[model samples]
Target chain A: MILARGLRKSFGDFEAVKGIDVDVRRGESFGFLGPNGAGKSSTMRMVAAVSPISGGELHILGMDPADDGPSIRARIGVCPQEDTLDTELTVRDNLYVYGRYFGLPRKEVRARVDELLEFVQLTEKADAMVEDLSGGMKRRLTIARSLINRPDVLLLDEPTTGLDPQARHVVWDRLFRLKQQGVTIVLTTHYMDEAEQLCDRLVVMDKGLIVAEGSPLTLIREHSTREVAELRFGVAPDGDSHEALAEKIADLGHRVEVLPDRLLVYSDDGEEVIARVHERGLEPVAVLVRRSTLEDVFLRLTGRTLVD
Target chain B: MALDQRADDQRAGSTAPTSTIAGAARLFDYWAIAYRRTWKGSAISSFVTPLLYVLAMGVLLGGFIKGDPTRLEGATSYLAFVAPGMVAAQAMTTVFGEVTYPVMGMIKWHKAYFGMTATPLSVPAVVLAHLGFVLFRVGTTCAVFLLVMAPFGVFASVTGVVAAFFVQLLIGLAFATPIYAFSAGLKDESAFSLVFRLGMMPLFLFSGAFFPITNLDPWMAALARATPLWHGVDLTRMLTLDRLDWSMVAVHVAYLAVLALAGWFWAVRRLSRRMIS
Candidate 1:
């Protein structure tokens, strides 16, 4: 449903998206997973045809986004990262007015508004002003508004960013249903769990480049170990205690990662590695063992830290 | 079958949703809605301001101006001379004040124009729609002002009142379009207050609205003739006093038409570039 070759978008001296190629198949959910400033929103805007591309060839459903932006946008639904809802009108009027922009008949728009209100579970608040809605309700309404034309391709930029856990799950469930109905979905998210639960295929983005592209499990298995053991040690008991610990586990595990507050042992058998640690006469404060996940893959690719 | 209907709607046409005609219709609809919302406020202000102006200026100030009460240049009273200018001034004020702030709000503050553009509405559609709404407002306000003028003996005949209303609309459009263009280009709201204080106030005071241009200083008279508002007020005064001359009529109509055309042309280009690009 979507294709891009060597996509590049730059703002003056800085490039937000640099020479990345991506493809999204029909009836599949694709994700761009990255930390902040990873060019996800820029890539989404390019695909939505709202921002002009600096250098790239993009085709949405076989139509060029540069030449046929209006037509391509007509068939695609975009839920932007920010809530750009019209606060002047009632919640239902926001939907109706947006539909009017698509040249829908008034009667059809009214009917769609009713159905979409129910779909987003906002039927009771249809007459309420948009400003009166909570964040979750507003996000749901924006999602419903995107579906006003029953678009074939749905683009969601961080669909569940600020919602509570329950609200996030509700959104995930609704999006899962859309995927079942053959709507091609492309979403950008910083949350690894969300990418794992929703995206069948995803790419890890960092600093305007895609570092790894694969399925969630494939990325985890390829970039990370099978299991990880986290050992938290107290302040150094003697000289170079962290280095001493790292030396003890150096041969036991495939790799030893030392953090300021903790040390991680990456290996196939975390239990055996923990036994080896115990045998070394080191008494750590905390020990945790778990199967590796996309979080580990992401951390391994883009270090463990917050970006903005 | 249902999906087919959706596809057909998607492929309907290339024209923007807010086409010129549809935009005009939507703007008219929004104005009607705005009127309903602001009617009580408009009613009190519209009735009170004109009544106060008539009582304060016509009755109180009329006693000071030396003139034949029944025939000041073929009019019954000074009230008759100043009443139509007030109406025209009100219309011009309504159009300029309404169109400028709202257009600036849509572009800079509210981001309403950006929201409108996301749909199939073109920038030109928004401009025409707003202009259409301003015209409607001017028409309605001028009508109410004319009705209020009647008991005060402002209208010499039915044709005079109708011509006065037409002249008010002409003045409103002539001022509104260029102002709308200027307002659209503004990046901040501060400039609007300056426009009203420095620009509009001067035009209102010196536009022959309160007195004859012949009575003013020669420099002020020249300034009044150059202003679009002066031409509008002059034509309205001539019509109300039943002293319509062919040459004066031609000059008044031609001046307003030229101003309207020029403003509209500038607005079309400015709005198209700002809204569409």
Candidate 2:
């Protein structure tokens, strides 16, 4: 539904989005995973046809964004990173007026507003002022407003950035239902678990460049081992630091990484690695064996945590 | 099925998304609905404020000035002369008031315009809708002001009052479009106070609204004549007093029209830059 090649965005002297390529298929859940300044929002804006690309080729639904921006925008829904909800109107009017912007007739918009209020689980608050809504409720109202026109593709930028865990789960559930209904979803997020839970395919970006692109499991498999063993020792005995401890158990696993507080041993068999660590007579304070995640893949590629 | 409906709507060619005027009107619908809820807030400005200005500036003050008829600009009464100028000045103030801080709030605080652009509406449509709303406000305010002043023997001709109403709309657009352009380009609202304190207040005081420009020194009179409010004031005064100078009328109309057109284009350019990037 969306395609880009060598896409670039520059604000005067600084380029936010360096050359990159992306292709999002119809009815698929796609994500852009990166740190705060990884050009994910810039790329999303270009695809949404709201930001003009400095140099690139982009086609949304087979139409060039530069020439057919209004037409392309007519067919897609965009939930921007900021809460741009109209503070002057009620929740129902927010949806109603937004539908009118797409040229929906008054009756049609009224009907759609009621249905969307129900879809976002905001029917009870439909008549309430927008400012009175909680953060999660406002976010849901924005999502409802974006879907007023029944857009073919939905673009969500940082969909759940500031929501509580329960609220995030609520939003994720609504989005998953949308995915099941065959609406193409494009989202950008810094949370590894959000990407893993929502995106069928994703790209890891850093410093305005895409470093790796694959499904979540595939990326973890390609960049990280099947399992990891985390071991924490009590304040290291003199000269027995994390680095030294890592060196001692380095041969027990495929690789050993020394952190300030813990030592990570990568291996296909976390149980065997833990056994070997005990065999070495290193009395550790804590040990955990867990499967690798997209967080691990991102760390392996960028050498920096996603949130930081 | 939804795509099919959208295609049919586009082909129909009169809906908001497919037509510029329709789209802008649809966007304007938002403000209209909002106004329904908030119209009471503006009652003071639209009705009470203008009424009070005419009562205080024209009636009470003009009571002393009517004794000196030579300086009353050939009008039969002081209330008659200053009333229409108040209407014109009120239009200017109303339009400026609507476009300045509210325009900034739309762009920076509420992000309402950004939300409109995310849909099928274009930047020009948003600008047009907002300016149209300003025109509506100026029209109603001027109409109410004229009505309230008529009982006091201010208007000489009923048709002239109608013409003055239309001129007030032009005056509103002439100020609104340019102020909108200025407000759209601002990063913060600190400059807006400068606009009011320096730009608008000076024009309101010396723009032939209370007295004739000819009463001023030559340089200041020329400065007053150069402003849109002076043209609006002169045109409105001439119409309400039943003195139709076709030549001067054409000049005033053409000047305000040119200013409105120029500001319209500049506003569109400024808004496009802010929104598209």
Candidate 3:
């Protein structure tokens, strides 16, 4: 549904999206996972065809935004990173007006408005002002507004950001239904779990470049181990003492990654690695054995958390 | 989810998406919906304020100028002279008021225009729709102002009121388009205050709305005639007072039309840069 080759976006001397290749297929959820300043939103904007590509080629629904922006936009839905809901109008009117903005007939828009209000579970708040709805409700309204035309592809930038876990799940469920109905979903997110739960495939972005790309588990398996053992020493013994601990356990596991507050022992058996740590007489403040995840893959690739 | 599948079944057949007229009307549709809820609040500016301006300036102050040979031109009453100018001025106010804060808010605050563009609507369509809404307001305020002027006997010809209404629309567009461009380029709204205090206030006071521009120093009169509102006031006065100078009327029309066209292009350019970038 969407394709790009070495797409570039720049503002004066600053390049927001460096040259990158991407493709989103039909009826599947594709994700761009990254931290802030990873240029995910810029890439999404280019794919949405709202912002022109500074260089390289892009074909959204087989149309170039430079010439066929309106028509391309007509066929796609976009839930931008921020809620651009019309606070001046009621929730119903927000959907109504947005549908009409697509040149949809008033009667069709009215029917769709009612149905979308129900789809978002906002039928009760249909008459209420958009500002009065909670952030989650507003986000749902934005999603509903994007679906007014049954867009073939939906571009969502940070769809679940700033939402509570429950709210995020509701949005995810709605999006999953859309995907099942054969709508291509392309979303940008900094949440590893959101990427894992929602995306069939994703690209990890950092510093205006794509660092890694695969299914969540594939990314984890390729860049990280099956399980990780996290061990924390009491107050790190001293500021410089964690380095000594790192040396002690460096030969215990296949690999040891040190953070200021904790040490990650990457191994097939995290319990066995902890045993080896105990055999070395290193008493720790805390220890956890957890399966490797997309978060681990991201840290392996970029050495930073998804959100920070 | 079962409910959703049923809901999907209900909307199975889709109407043809494109409409020849609906595209242009899309943004106006938004403004229309918004106005439906807020129209009453605007009666103060549209009807009452214009009425009060005529009462304060044309009737009460006009009470002092009925027989003045210099100001009244020894023809119609002073009320007739100033009524249409107030209508034109009111139209300018609604236009300026909308294109300033609301335009800035659409760009920076509410992001309403951003929402519109996310659909098939382009930035140019958004700009045109906003300007179109301002024109709709100018039409409403002028129409109402003319109606209120009816009982006052300020109109020499009923058709002249119609002519003045169109001129107010022109004047409003002339101001709205460029001010929209200016407002869109702004990083903040500090310049909005300057727009009214420095630009609009001077034009309102010295634009021959109440007195003839010729009453001023020749240079000041020339400068007043250069402003869009002055041209609006001049044309409105000629139409309302039954003194249509065909050549001067043509000049006034051409001047405002040129400015409106120029402003429209500038706004389109400014908005395209902001949105498509």
Candidate 4:
């Protein structure tokens, strides 16, 4: 339903979004997973038709955003990073007024307001002022507001960034329901688990570029081993010892990943690798055996430290 | 039977309804929200300023000029002459002030315009909606001021009140349109402050709001006569004192109409260019 080729956005001398290509299919959850300033928000804004693309060929719902912005936007729902609810309005009025902006009739707006309020679980507080709602409630109301037009595609930017664990789960459940209804969802988040849980396909973005793209499990299996054995050596292994340990594990597994405080042995079987280490008499302080996940895939692709 | 009926209702309601008038109606809804949310501050400033000016300049200052035929202007009291000007001045000030700051806030500080633009509402629709609210406010303030002036023996006849209301609307449009244009071009809040200080204050003082422009020097009087506010004040004063001259009234109307048209044209061009580009 959405396609972009050589899409670029620049502010003066600095480029926020370099030339990149993306295509999102209908009825699938797609995500852009990146740290802050990784061009996720910039890319979303271009898709939302709020920001003009500097250079690109873009289409949403088979219409060019440059020429058909209003018509394209009419069929899409967008939940921005910051809540833009009219704070002076009642919760129900927010939905009704937003519906009116799309030229919805008053009767239909009223009906849709009631229906959306029920969907977001805010029917009881429909008449309450928006300022009186909590952060989680406000986010839900924003989501409800976006759906007033019953849009074909929904864009959510960091939908659960500041929510508590319970609130995050509630939002996730609501989003899951939307997906079940066959709505196309596109979102951006720094949370690895969120991407894994929600996105059927995702692209890992770094420095305004796409570094990797695939399903969560496919990415993990491609970029990392099936099993990882974490070993922590006591007294912080010296350079010589670290080299020796890397050499020892190199023969035992397909790959050996060394950190400042720990060593990772990547192999097909964690137990087999551990048994090999025991036979070699390399006493370690601790050992943990776990399956590979998106976190390991991401860390391996884009380092562990946060990027601005 | 009930289940069948509910299913029928759902089928009937599934088709979306649309309206061409929805855009204008939604703008009014937004204005209603702004008015209800900011009623207290809007009321105090619009009503209180004219009343205080009437009290201080008309009643208090009138005591010192007691029995001075030159200051009284025929049979009209000092209160009568000054009250209508206050009404006209307040209407201009109130409308100009309300439209500029709030419109700029929507554009920059709060980003309300961005929010509105994301919807199907057009940019011209937003600008017109804001002007509609400004008109409503200018009308209300003028009506209340006229009521207050009538009890204080400010009006010579009912025509005076009608003329005052008309003048208020004219002056408001004249001031509001250019300010709207200026606001669209504003990069910072300081530009608005500078316009108010250097432009608005001078127009208020020199536009015959307090005293007759004839008392000023010839060049300054000509400058005042060129302004819409001066035409509004002169026409309002003439109607209040029942000194109705058809030629002079025609001139005033023509002057205000031209100024309003010029400002509106500038505003429309600037707003459409800025938003659409």
Leading candidate by DockQ: 2
C-alpha RMSD of candidate 4? 4.8
Fnat of every candidate, listed in order: 0.14, 0.60, 0.61, 0.27
Candidate 1: which docking quality band?
acceptable
Instruction: List candidate 4 stretches off by more than 4 Å.
Output: A228-290, A304-308, B1-24, B40-49, B66-75, B108-110, B181-202, B217-228, B242-277
Per-residue CA lDDT of model 2 for A28-116, tens digit only, reads: 99999999999999999989888989998889989998888888888888999998998979999889888888877788889888988
Tens digit of per-residue lDDT, candidate 3, span A1-308? 78889889998999988888988876789999999999999998888878989998999978898888778888788999999888978999999888887777789899999989999999999999988998899999999999998877888999989999999999999988887876789999999988998899999999899999888988988999899999998874244477778998887666788787889988889999998888877899789999998888888887777765
Off by over 4 Å in 2: A233-241, A258-261, B1-16, B67-70
Colliding residue pairs in candidate 2: none
Worst 10 residues of 3 chain B by lDDT: B11-20
Candidate 4's error at A174, in angstroms?
0.9
RMSD per model, one decimal: 4.0, 2.4, 3.1, 4.8
Candidate 3 chain A, run of 10 with poorest lDDT = A235-244
* Interface RMSD, in order shown: 3.8, 3.4, 3.7, 4.8
**lDDT (10s digit) by residue, model 4, range A1-308:** 89989988887778888987899998899999988888999899889877788887888988888877777777788888888887777898888877777766679889899998999999999989988998899899989988887777899999998999888888898899999987889999988889989999999888788889999889988999999998888874353477677887788877787777788888879988888898888877898899987767767887763333
Top candidate by lDDT: 2
* Ordering by lDDT: 2, 3, 1, 4
Count of steric clashes across candidates, in order: 1, 0, 0, 0
Please write out the lDDT profile of model 1 over residues A168-214, one tens digit for every residue.
Answer: 99899888888887778999999888999999999999889899999
Candidate 2 falls in which docking quality class? medium
